[model samples]
Target: MSEKAMTDIRNDPAAATRHDIALSIDKVRGVLEALRFGSITLTVHDARVVQIDVTEKTRLHA
Candidate 1:
């Protein structure tokens, strides 16, 4: 199978405040592109994405 570019955002915030700080698709795409190739883990707390970690992939394909 061919590899396809994709982004997965896991919304772990509370139900009520989930819609308060919504990220646009374009913004998200730009963020991912800026990081180049790697893995990013979004850390969320209190209905907000507080941190981002860009780590290199250890294996050939992960």
Candidate 2:
């Protein structure tokens, strides 16, 4: 995406609040909710979320 195209934000507050944030949030929430042992890594680019990485660890009980 072009610099202008990427930084283009000409709309209301709701418009500014797009799925980018919402979806990322939902994903983060989901990971946290179902995570018992693991880590969540967020990748950001140009102030935007570019990726979401989840590392889940399985625990064995004695």
Candidate 3:
């Protein structure tokens, strides 16, 4: 998601007012949870979370 999208989600007080919006937010949360062990990058503008990026890593054993 772009910074604007993230910001909109974060800043929107009516997000939970709509079932679809709430579900969408929940889906995003799920994705973040799944990527918990991965590298996460948060871009902040004015001390607010604006963007998130996740990078997963795998280890190979001989």
Among all windows of 10 consecutive residues in model 1, the one with the lowest summed lDDT is 1-10
How close is each model in CA RMSD to the real structure? 13.0, 6.3, 8.5
Write candidate 2's Cα lDDT for 1-62 as tens digits: 45554455443444445736877888889889999999999999866688989899999999
User: What count of clashes does model 3 give?
Assistant: 0
**Stretches of candidate 3 exceeding 4 Å from the true structure:** 1-29
Q: For candidate 2, report its TM-score.
A: 0.62
TM-scores for all candidates?
0.41, 0.62, 0.42
Error of 2 at 29 (Å): 0.5
Measured by TM-score, the strongest candidate is: 2
Model 3: per-residue lDDT, tens digit, 1-62? Answer: 67786677677756423534455466568678787456767665754455667788776679
- Cα deviation at 54, candidate 1, in Å, is 1.3
Q: Report clash pairs, candidate 2.
A: none
Output the lDDT of residue 14, model 3: 62
Better of 2 and 3 by lDDT: 2
lDDT of 3 at 41: 72
User: Arrange candidates by lDDT, highest first: which order?
Assistant: 2, 3, 1
On a 0 to 100 scale, what is the lDDT of residue 59 in model 3?
67
TM-score of candidate 3 to 2 decimals: 0.42
Which runs of model 1 end up more than 4 angstroms from their true locations? Answer: 1-20, 23-27, 57-62
Q: If both were scored by TM-score, which would come out higher, candidate 1 or candidate 3? A: 3
